[model samples]
Target: MNKSKWLYFWGLLITVAIIVISCHHLPPSKSSVTIKLSGWGGSPVEQKLLKQVLQDFEVKHPNIKVKYEVISDQYMDVIKTRLIGEAAPDVFYLDALEAPFLMSQNVLEPLDNYITPEFDLADFEENLLNSFKYQKHIYGLPKDYSTLALFYNKKAFSKAGLDSPPNTWNELRSYSQQLTGKLNKYGFGESPELARQAYKIKAYGGKIVDKKGNATFASESGLKGLNLVIDQYQKERTSVLKSDVGASSGSDMFGQGKVSMVIEGNWAIPYLQETFPQIDFATAEVPTINNKKGTMVYTVAYVMNKQTKHKQAAWKLISYLTGKEGMEKWTGKGFALPTRKSVAEKLGYDQDNFRSALVAGVDYATPWQVGKYPAAIANNFDNQFISALLGEQPLNQAMLRAENNANQQIKMME
Candidate 1:
């Protein structure tokens, strides 16, 4: 009720009002951002491991959240459609086989500008990293990869009195003949698809596609390499297709003791171990073709959308997922081999008995990308190549037909 007390109360009220107005006018604090990520469906275990990695990312970056989606089938088709509609995710998985087309489409964000020195761009394998590069701009970062290797059953080798895996094309044929009808119905299981045979085409200085994206694998050099496969299957009768053994895949036939040897990728390791635990097997670099070592390498990368509203956050997610720590966790279980040299060395894959051959082949392996239009080339080649393998036509005739048909389709696509 006194004058002095009333004055003090009024001053306190004015100070409180000034502070409230100042706080309201200041810039709002940074808010959390949600980035949408999409990828094709993987195995249950792989899905779980990825979820854990995302959770860790969220914890590390409290301001960012991730929304993940899985396109179960027709993944590339769905992604292309969504990209055209401008409704694609901020980040998505891009297979090296499909990278060329997308990288050239202008719909992908070049990560080169965003990549920092701490990211260690040089840590990636040159071949794998180059798969996602277009015009010297990096469009994506490879997360993992697999190179084909020769897998042979130890028990079957013992039965055939073969001490080790074949070292050359001729040796492989001789080994196949010695093991056929004694260890299993077929000594070697063959996949007649172009993906498995492209390296063979290259071993003899042949190319799968020209610079302009046309099929050209029917040349003399290409056939020279391919004849090795045809001779073993048609003339020697030591090799059999998966269908011949009533198996779904090469690994399946080998696991069931229907075949003694097979050429497959790293994926077969876990499948065989869990599917047929009792089957003892060892892996070796794919036997040399014409005295030149070669195999096919497959890889997938995490790419950013050019229209992303959250570029920084998306880059963070990609870098973390492909970084050394995250890659170690993802590849530690051996589902897929690491693409980074440091990660592979740290994991001891080079010393692993069953995985060493697969690791070693990365240096000389041919990547499984054949220019911008692969489906056309692969489908035509597969159909005609199978026809040849089944004795429906001559090898040269079948390859010529495939090459012509693939070029026509590629023209339409262009």
Candidate 2:
């Protein structure tokens, strides 16, 4: 048995001991890279859903960590300030309305380099994707989108003896007349904001802004479309604003049975279901105007800060969050609609009873982007539009004044 065998056993034990001690002393695998993500605060349910998504992402990417923060009020202003100071989150939400300005500023990282063929850029709706593109470079990927649809209280419609939602603008007006009560309820709830009425301008071949981004919504064609809104509120008196009806929003007006129909986005779906469960409601595409179907699409994308040190990790987060798998989870509950055609088809939102109308309008819905000076244009239009709606001024006069004022503000900004 002897000295040779004993020496061999001793050497093997020593070798095993050395290997175990070396492994124990070696540094723990590098700590996960923490990437900051920021977005405006949403409803409790929405926040919970997002937390679930982030948790799932962490599980899949063990080497990456997420630090989420909520910018509760004046979200864009806060984001812009942080970005100017080079203190913005690694990834954050950027709305379509603000995309043009941000993309032009060069503060956002171009995502084209990180996009792979497998990412299936073709799968996203071209219209939504185009909103985040500037000079052929993609700056962000839309996380979700919502298109306006006619949400009608079925009970109210039936009581008014209407069989279905209006299919055309004329029918909508007639239906509104029949549904409007002396003072208690309005047939239609109107938002009267530029974002809501931009399509109406285009319906008559009016451009909201010229190629140079100056306001041109006061054109003859634009007045023709806007006049319809003013007439509905003043002439017909069948429509009411949320303020007029003591409601916080058009959705609230409709939900409270103050209005039989309202043009609202998908976000209202969950709200109505939760807050107004007793209301029997359904959705249809916004009624066609001047023989053309139109609606507005609102979307927000996940954008990376150009100054982020962890570019690759940030891209991974963006890809997964906007990708089919993550999107399915995020939009599955119908709080928001998917931007990808593949994901939409998988979720069957296009065929869903409540969401079908919204999905139907995606192809034709005008995106709610008004060039780089949207804030100025929107402010001027809203102020003057309400005047027209209230009969304080003629539609033509109001729009002309708005267009002039908005352009002047734009020049001042420049």
Candidate 3:
């Protein structure tokens, strides 16, 4: 009796031990899967917050484990080299500006294939979602986005006795003049830099490039958009270039109260809130021009490297981050605006009380889309454009030269 009972208990224990030892071989439905998630590493606060979020994600998906990797400060350089070596992270950050290049290089897996019918992909902002698309196939889904908004100082407005924020270009000019003072605390900022020219370009229906990706916007309407900015500093003299002001950056001037208003993005919120809490400021849509209302949009997407061996796990991480729940949690800290219309609505960003005007701009806003000529147009025009803003060259002539040189560089690259 004792031998048989002891043998039965031993057999049961050995069977359970074997199952535990073979746990790693279990199917994905029952197995724990580890995936690499990488993005721009940040300050201590951000690191802590992100780690907690990752922990929460692990809690929700007990079978899925996230390995958070801080893709260095030189994010693109490191990411591109990893892609070249076929050792890129399963999930990584891809800027909207870089989406066209990465997608065309066969470096990103098309996300449309992984997306399921039940995912509610339509909840995303069309422009942001479209930015990650190539050949009519979406490569990535946007996690968040930011638009250029005019941030105005209330104290400056009160000092000038202005009734409200400018809605029309004419009012902007007049308001700029009235707010400029002898102390060089100018009314406005010269912020239509090459990095943020999309607003002006779209305001006048000027195409930066045609369907075939050519620099077509260096035309009459484009010139008007370009000149409209230069004229503010060159002719009206009501606004000051960032270089002319001691700030060296437009947002800095607004923060320091050196300028009454400046065009900036949502990332500035935390900085402004923490550093310059005393500044009574609010955000509005960029002043309307040419009888058309418009704003500039930029987005960040979660992309998978085409070379990733763990394609299934990679897709799962990407889909999770861009998914409604994940985006709502990731952007819940108010560090960014959600790219999904549903998430934005959930965040109350669609009709937010404080920054409603800026949120109202998502409908008509145009993405900051330029051709993938290695950012030739942007790089070539950046310094020269800033120089033009400094009154170092005639606006028309400087832009013409920029257009010629950029096209030449593009031709050589082709």
Candidate 4:
């Protein structure tokens, strides 16, 4: 009775211990994954908002974790370097300006396969979405965008005896004359960057680059539109650069009462409100040129690195962040304007008095992208266009030289 019973009891105890140890060693049914996301740093408020969004994303997708990092400075250069080394984050912000180059480099994952009909690709502003498309493949989804609009100081306009912002380029010029009263205050604030002036070039059928991707903004049509800027600065003497008024940007010039009107983007709204709350200002769609309406639209998109090891989790993160609900949160504070038409309507930004003008320009706005050599084209155009405005050279000659120089630089890069 004692020996057989003891052996049976020991066997049963050992079997139970083996089962417990095996269960402890077995993998769980669901494992958590961590994916890295990166973007250039924004304002502290924006960072806090992004953190909250990420927290919400984690709550919705508990099996996936996000590791967010800020590149802080030289965002694109750092991102490109990381991409070349195959050390980039699974997801990162890619400006439309840089998207053309990256999309052509085959380092980004084409998002077409992941995009389902339910994603509602149609809801994105077509032009904004097209900025991230190359060769019929969608490489990224736009997260936010901003469009140029006429930002006028309401008090300044009232003081000038003007009832409303100008509706045409001619009206703008005439209004400038009336608004320029004090020596310190100019009628219009001008930013002579290529991104700002590209639309003007397009106003008269000018192309920024030829089919070969060489700079070609010095043509007859180009000068026809650019000459308007030159005339306003050199001949009319009504417009002033921010530097002339000791301000950092067009928005600052308007905020400081150095200019009555300035063409700026949605970013200026919060900046003006926060930095110069005492000033009463309003935004209007940029006035028409050559009987055609136009403005510059800037956008940035979320793209996935082709080298990411966790593709499924990374796509989940990307899809959520750029999806309808997430975009609503990102743009709700109006730090940036929403890219999705539905989200914009939901946020009521399309009807916002300050933002509606920006939204209106979307239909006719030219994206601030010029093929894959924007940096070169922009540098040359800005350098020469300012010279033209300053009367250092005629507009035609300056643009011609700029086109030549930009093309030379592009050839070298090739």
Candidate 5:
């Protein structure tokens, strides 16, 4: 044979050999794919349960595997990077605050196509569901939620001779005054930096922001809430920051007996149980503002990247995680409230007195959304509000400054 023909024949033989060897070694060219599920870092406790749940899912859906990726910090930075590079996970945890931005970008896969009647989107709380929806299509699904609760030391209450938790804003004020110590041990306190916290208002139907994202602090109701917080420093020096309480959090103050009472979230439950095991405490719904119950509701949801290669598989995981049985397992540990109503009952979450208050709060509490420009609004509000809390700025002036900053940001967005 001619030299050229001989070389071509050898090349053809080598190509066929490579194709056969590659096929033989490849792992069964899996129709079953492993999807990546990204979320913020969690404690060991959370990891144990989550790993178990993921394993359970793998067992049931033998064709799919979930790769858990915990993003520890600068969550958006990493997520944005992956998304821009089209290397984002199949599914990721999206905060309600950031969901609007992601949804607006058309980067999230709308679960609508994957949602079946069996998925039961109706089973989830409407308000929380509203937070995940963008332009009338649901973009994410919440596996769990958290709500603010009034936590008070029973020993402190006994000292103050209070028999029951305060039910209204006036009662809260009265209780705070009565509980104030002659020294550093204060009567009551809360995280002042979180202004839109539904539980942090006067009992007068006060709101943090209007539908248009305008600051409501200048309103009479807003002033009342600010005044109540302002009085904590001026009226008495008893109220302490959660940091001062020898605890890492506001709820820690109540747990360590630094303050008689404080409003915080369910996250404090495990912290107190693990850190300060001896504290006697009771939990109740936050005091009613404006004769109506109130509490801050915080929620996060599983969002799919628009750039994902496995849209269908990504959605199966989302549906499974937020579905009734999935939600039950996700929130079954009392670590958080289930976003779905049925799972709340199935997991006996409604039976726990303290935890159950969060169930009621789901109906009345405000969404933790501070609008599209959360960072700007939160930073300005927190800075000015802290100044107000420390008595550096008068309540009205501080609020005005915060309002101006936030409005200026919004106008700039416009």
Candidate 6:
């Protein structure tokens, strides 16, 4: 109606238009993507540490969300069932022992294309990295690993007047004899499982599995190494199994003052320290077997699902977890050793008093993987080995029976 009122209305309309135009040029907000990850349950502390690391990842990746699940029982069985049903997590843990079978099944996503130069793939230990490779393609990246080491009770050693750990198998037997009936029930505790004895078999140049995935660890050379175990259990009677002493494991046998020495991994450090705080213990590289160093190494990796809809998000989680920064945090508490060489160096596990011996053995250790048919081989070997230990049958006869049974089972699968 009036000139001044008309001018005010026009100015307000121009101001509103300018504000709308500026808003359109601003950066669009990132769309969020959530991925599921699954792993077996661990100790409370380990779980807390992993949760913290995952939280850190979420903070750095504001657009991504992680849904984590812990399969506490029958982990591999449940994982396999979930995989076939197409309900498996986008990323999950794969142990080296089961990698061969799973990698052959064409269920896993190859990680080579997503890996970049900045990821420093070369920093991983060759043995660990190789475990997840099949037919020239990398299927998984190892998160952590452990190797067997001699765990000795320091007070028991002092009572037996021994100054240091045994350097050879013969010395170990002798030390076992001296330590027995003095400060403990037995001088050495043995874990009769094949996972613990596979290194012994290898020390005599024995092969556990043929290229065809058949069991072949019953040869003369394999028998020779196994005889070392038999002699100590029957003739020397200086070593005993956990079952014989009514203990749960080699660590428990040693912790309960029933044995002076046991072979275990880095996991035993925290367990022993917390569960049996009064017992003082020390670790050393396993005694040389047949004049050569030998031990068993176990490792697990993070693998991707081929059917995943969110490949980039899954890769980000895997890369961050197996990457240097994430690995340092995971292995910082020393529950497990880092699989990456750089992370191991940064954590100084090689220099740690309790873990140094374990780190030294990795160079010569036999990975705890039999073949694609690991269950058949391991189950038969463990059963027969125990029968022989209990004097139910001769060692040679027991091993031959185990070898035949394992091969038969493998043939059935093939």
Candidate 4 worst ten-residue window by lDDT:
178-187
Candidate 5: segments with Cα more than 4 A from true spot: 1-30, 182-184, 195-207, 210-216, 243-247
Model 3 lDDT on a 0 to 1 scale: 0.78
**Model 5 lDDT, full chain set:** 0.78
- Which should have the higher lDDT, number 1 or number 2? 1
Q: Per-residue CA lDDT of candidate 5, range 1-414, in tens?
A: 999999999999999999999999888755888899999988888988998988888898888989998889899989989888889998999888777768878778887888888777788899898999888898988878887888878777887888999998678778877887722268876677764443455355566667787766566666776676677666756566765556666866666677777877888887888888888778898887666677778899998888888888888788778877777787878887889887788777777867877677888777788776677777777888878787787878887888788888888886
What C-alpha lDDT do the candidate models reach, one value each?
Answer: 0.94, 0.93, 0.78, 0.91, 0.78, 0.93
lDDT of 1 at 192: 94
**Global fold similarity of model 1 (TM-score):** 0.95
For every model shown, what is its TM-score relative to the native structure? 0.95, 0.95, 0.90, 0.94, 0.88, 0.96
RMSD (CA, angstroms), candidate 2: 2.4
Per-residue CA lDDT of model 1 for 257-306, tens digit only, reads 89899999999999999999989999999999888999999999999999
The model with the greater TM-score, 3 or 6, is 6
Give lDDT tens digits, candidate 4, residues 117-177. Answer: 9998999999899999889999999999999999888887877778988999999999999
What is the lDDT for 26 in model 6?
88
Position 17, candidate 2: lDDT: 100
In every candidate, how many clashes are there? 0, 0, 0, 0, 5, 0
Model 3, 41-86: lDDT tens per residue? 7667767876777787778778789999986678988988989988
Model 6 TM-score, 2 decimals: 0.96
Give the per-residue Cα lDDT of candidate 3 at 39.
Answer: 90
**Residue 203 local lDDT, model 4:** 92
The 10-residue segment of model 1 with minimum total lDDT is 178-187
Cα error, residue 324 of model 4, in Å, equals 0.8
RMSD of each: 2.5, 2.4, 3.4, 2.9, 7.0, 1.6
Ranking by TM-score: 6, 2, 1, 4, 3, 5
